[model samples]
Target: MRTMMTRRQLLQSIGSGFGMMSFAGLEAASDPLAARQPHFPARAKHVIYLFLNGGPSQVDTFDPKPALTRFHGTSAPSGNLKTERKTGALLKSPFAFRRHGQSGLEFSEIFPKLGACADDLCVIRSMYTERPNHEPSLFMFNCGHVLPGHPSMGSWLTYGLGTFNRNLPGYVVLCPGVPVIGPQLWTSAYLPAIHQGTYLPNNESEPEKLIQHLRNRNLSAEEQRRQLDLLASLNRLHLEREGGDAQLEGRIQSMEVAYRMQSEAMDALDVSREPAAVRARYGDGDFARGCLIARRLVERGVRMVQVYYGNGQPWDNHDDIQIHRRLAATSDAPMAALLQDLKASGLLKETIVLIGGEFGRTPSVEVSGLVRVQNGRDHNNHGFSILMAGGGVKGGLAYGSTDEFGFKAVEKRTHPHDVHATILHLMGMDHTKLTYRHAGRDFRLTDVAGTVVRDIIA
Candidate 1:
């Protein structure tokens, strides 16, 4: 019979060889949020994803399909695309489109503010996903899989690049209220909990309310530091007695970070300190305030910051597609302000900005059995549109295209995995090389499939 060697016993046998070196490596790995080097020189040091929670109608937004008007209320072709609900005849966009910027990128009337800044935007009109439903598509966008229990793109970035600022979380998610799938969308499944996005409800602009329990009312800064040091020492002693545990080490590191955050987080999250003109530029509202804070966070060295549009699929206009104009109104000013501010601050050169949702709405009008919807569209995973700017992406260029009817991606089609790969590439990470071994297989953000869309790179 062969006897199995315990980890301690194996370490004892290898003590004279590489035991000390191995222990040193383990200690270094303890601080999961500690900054690490990228695979190569990175074009984007930070990322800010403006996630429009519900699928936005591409035909009504970035992609202008005049063909819809030509075929409006007419049914001739029997091969129309199927959707989540039974759709009526083609619906023409109520809003008008006008060319903007030197690129001649067309923008709908609703996004006049964003349209003015069109030169900096790279609109991809041929984007598609695997699912049409919110839950699966949301998971697909954030975690790279239709199913849950996978690390999100933010988590992967933090895991790969670690954190630039220890005082604040490397990955931050700002939403006024929970989206449909909730925290699972930002979860760091299979990755260290520390890499999970730090969710902040922007409903209240108060810094204290945004970051609950940020300060200890009873303990002064010095006293809190002393307490943290003692607690860390005790934890270290316990770790030495019980071999190394990743979870325990993570908890210890989190405690240390929490202690440090008490001093800096308050100042970082407080947007009221901004100049009056700057505050006025971003406007007043949870989404707008979240955008301002996102800029502030990226400026302070946070790796990835996601500002969701609003709570619970706010853009899912089932009854009236005209509601899109209202939603766009709320977003245009803040988004434009963010881009302009980043450029003025010179942060735009090093930060990547992504805007879009999980999927897009169908071009044809949708009619549900449960209710009557006159102007709204159904979910369309066949095609969608998203915009990217800054980083290393070419500005003022629209890549790929959808068909004339705007029902599907017909030319130079791109998938979410491809986008993920492109994003990691911009961040100087080879999606294939950046992998975590689990379940006896190497898992990655791109999964088994992903091809970097290199043409968009500046």
Candidate 2:
């Protein structure tokens, strides 16, 4: 039988050639999720973002203002700062604060379990954002831009470093239901769509229900493989005709990932396989389940896992600030368990765990017509707090602070850009150098502003 030359082979034999150049990079382009080397010596290999959606009150959690407590029900000195709604006298945190562990890091009464892990947490009390509203701030926190059409930090990481396991997605998002901004929060935007986060609505306990259509009931693995091969050939031919299409290539890559996932994805997502004792430690609730799943994903070589606390900004406690205590109760145990579990498994040193919300709440009572209760706090974009643990960060350190009333970042003031830059730096990428050409210019997670806050790094 005579050997038939395919279009790829025909071009390869013609001079130094188009096929040689294009197909040489073909394998690399086809496997976009293949693991790659970091820009330098990376301190961390994985990141787990514990997104506490909406604004959690800093004064009620990590940042305690003695002045606010002292002058409770009195006008704040910094009350002149503009807020989204009208506010009244200073609302002192109802929850008391106390020092924990050798770090002496203070925590609110609601977070006893998390406070136990204080020695491992690096609290940033001076975190600020560009907006007081949820939508823009969420965009800023996740995508580095105050707009929706930008790749999230997780998307950027997966795009930059890829993943170790080709059987699973490089980036994963866990939420019981739709988050505030929905899928846009994790979109790849100008980046290849394959780099976008694989979202899992983790409402079900069973792995099959957790990830719908995870297994095909109609076809065997071998049969499915043959079908995919044929489909791939057709896609490649179409791709050649179109010259090149990033979106089309992305879909091809994503199809391969979905196929490979049939082998390992279910096992990775099933929390029931974990020991009964382990389940007890993580506790019961959507947030708890998400924390456990985050650990599992990172353990299995996923580049990044973003676990949102709940759906529709559950932490947006505009009516009653006491709701924070209830929310913290549900999240505290799981947060601590994740830290302890990572440390026990020796993954803590190479995995970064970031915990915080979009912004923080005002120290004064929210007395606006929009608010239902008289005791709630307004949104405060000027100041907030976030916690970082493991991944070569200096634990037990509070790097910055808000003023006496906890209204604004006063010292060592840090922005969302700074946090993004610092996270990239820890993962061995220079913030300024991590760029992707989109439209007519280059875009990055930190945009034009961001300095690696190296002091927090070990």
Candidate 3:
């Protein structure tokens, strides 16, 4: 018996590792690179991650604490929690929180529409990170590693599942510009190039500006077709001779897939085709447009769609927290409408929608004597919050939480690793079992610590 190797296999081997002490320490299951099998029967087939680029303050959004109002401008009741910069005093939330929906979930005044869909959200208020800074936290949030170079969550999903639809990419990421930590978060790392995310910015709206090298102006369709045909023949020959080469086979499949996708993907991108009424509901910003495009792609079988709000550190409200009103307004309605639309169209059952950022803002004020109309908060990886909906997640419930001042997670603390595990679980992939071997050690997305929170699973 002979074993064949291709770029995909080689990279996967590197991902899982052939080295010592790599995969052994992780909490995941034994075999990390056993041909990517499903953990159990899958309840959902796709995922849409509404990545809030800057960390959104949980207190201002999902987790509402009345104590902040009662004790305005004071300390955090003498707790060990510390902010990045020395803070003056605890600032009370200028915005009030209200309970909404049948589940009676609580949300700040900024998100009335999202509050209307509270029952659909599994709000986890106790999510923490290993770092307080933006770069590492962003990397950790998307790649399960504080260090760079690991495969992103999107890349992992694409690698684990080749994709239900070959015409469109398995992993799609939408953002206006470079984000914190740059492309590392969505990178495929050691995975095959095909598994990496297909990034589309706001300018990609038009077919002419969508992808840089995608549409070749130099060659006509017939010419490009001939080039791809020739390349496909060479790749197939290499694959046949190599005997089960993952990379070569993937390339062969990818070229034809790319060719088929040009028109189809462009068509899905054309939101103008949608009714005027539907477009208004999603808002008119570039981010909102991306969200609408995401819906179309997911409907057409794209596996994972991550629509990031704002560019680098927009949510980093260090000086004035009051300004979050603008940020909150940008994300709130479109997210709620997305949930309702998915539910109404029956797509929610098979699609998972998640909203949150790397971490939450600190409870204290940070700017110089600026009147705290809307104060800014520092990064708090100790305990932030995230809102999850659709897919198999039960409607109308909140899971996990932080302490009284919304500083740290006290009960049902859900770490980023746990969230990763749960996301994998929702897609029916066992986090422990999904491994890639790299540098002689087995590598997994969980990186030695993760357990799918069964309670949150519907």
Candidate 4:
């Protein structure tokens, strides 16, 4: 029997005597999602980012500004900081704030469930970003860039450490609907596509609908396995001839993951499998369900899971800041339950949990064309708040502060890049060294500037 070889393969068999070595390298590259070691001992093995989708009001959530209450209906002491829209006098948070837990961490009435777990939270009240618009801010938070082409933090982590479970993706995104910035927020961009986040529109609880084409409808399990074996053989041949094209390699890897997922993903995503008490603890809603799935995925050794609060910037309350109360009601219980469950299961020690939005709302009231909007607040990029828990962070502490009016980050200021750096550091990666060379320059998650806020570290 004679074996036919393509021109590239023929040359590879005879060229430079390094074909075997090159082929070995190609074989390693073929499984880019294979688990790899981190730069050092990792503090956190997994990360769960509970992105609030839109800008949540800092004063109304974690950072309670007593000054706002004192000066209600009066012009802000610092005057109106330029925001996305016109604003009026200071608007106090309607929900009363009370100190909770042994830490005495103040929380608004909207997050009663979270308040019970306040001691476990390290609230950063001085978070700021460069933009106020939804697109740029979302990009900044997710990708560390104001532009759209950078890989997200999840992608960077996946590329750095890969995944523990080959059956599941390294990075998964759960959103009931597309966010304001769409898929760009989770895109891998210049990185291999395999590192990009696998988005699951979790509006539906059924695993089959949540993940389209998850099962082989026509072929039986064994038949599909045989077909996949044949397909992989062909793909490997094409990959060898093409000298390991990244896209082709990624596709091949994706197909294998999809195949393996058919066996386990359904069970992982099925919230009904949990005890009724457990399900009830997390509450009943899409966001709550996503939190549960995040826990399950991380428990199964998935590297990163991001649960976007909702589609189309639900937290962007430019009209009625009261809407934040409603949004918080929907998310607070699940958010708290996630932490409690992780702690109870011992996953909290190794899992990083982050809760925040793109930015925050202005301290002053926003005045639009009508009087009805006077209760709303405009977008404020100067300052905000975010909560971090477990994953080697110092709990029962508030690390930073906004001004008296909650208008600006006055002390221990932090940026999105800093957050990225801190997260990578927790994952045992040096943000400065975790670079991917593209366009003739080595790009990192922190970009040009970011200092890991050591104060927040445990």
Instruction: List per-prediction Cα lDDT, in the order shown.
Output: 0.86, 0.88, 0.78, 0.87
Judged by TM-score, which candidate is best?
Answer: 2
lDDT of 2 by residue, 60-97 (tens): 99998888878998897655478788888988889999
Q: Sorted by TM-score, highest first, which candidate order results?
A: 2, 4, 1, 3
lDDT of 2 at 219: 99
| Candidate 3: stretches off by over 4 Å | 1-4, 7-37, 216-223, 232-257, 367-374
TM-score of candidate 2 against the unseen true structure: 0.94
**Residue range 190-265, candidate 1, lDDT tens digits:** 7766778889999988999998888899999888876876676566556557975556666766777677788678
The alpha-carbon lDDT assigned to residue 188 of candidate 2 equals: 93
By summed lDDT, which 10 consecutive residues of candidate 4 come out lowest?
Answer: 1-10
Runs in model 2 deviating more than 4 A are 1-30
Number of the predicted model whose lDDT against the real structure is largest: 2
Q: Model 1, clash count?
A: 0
- By lDDT rank, best first, the candidates go 2, 4, 1, 3
Q: Give per-residue CA lDDT, model 3, range 45-110, as digits (tens).
A: 889999887888988888887777777787667753665665657777778889888888898999
lDDT of 4 by residue, 67-116 (tens): 89899999976579998888889999998998999999999999999999
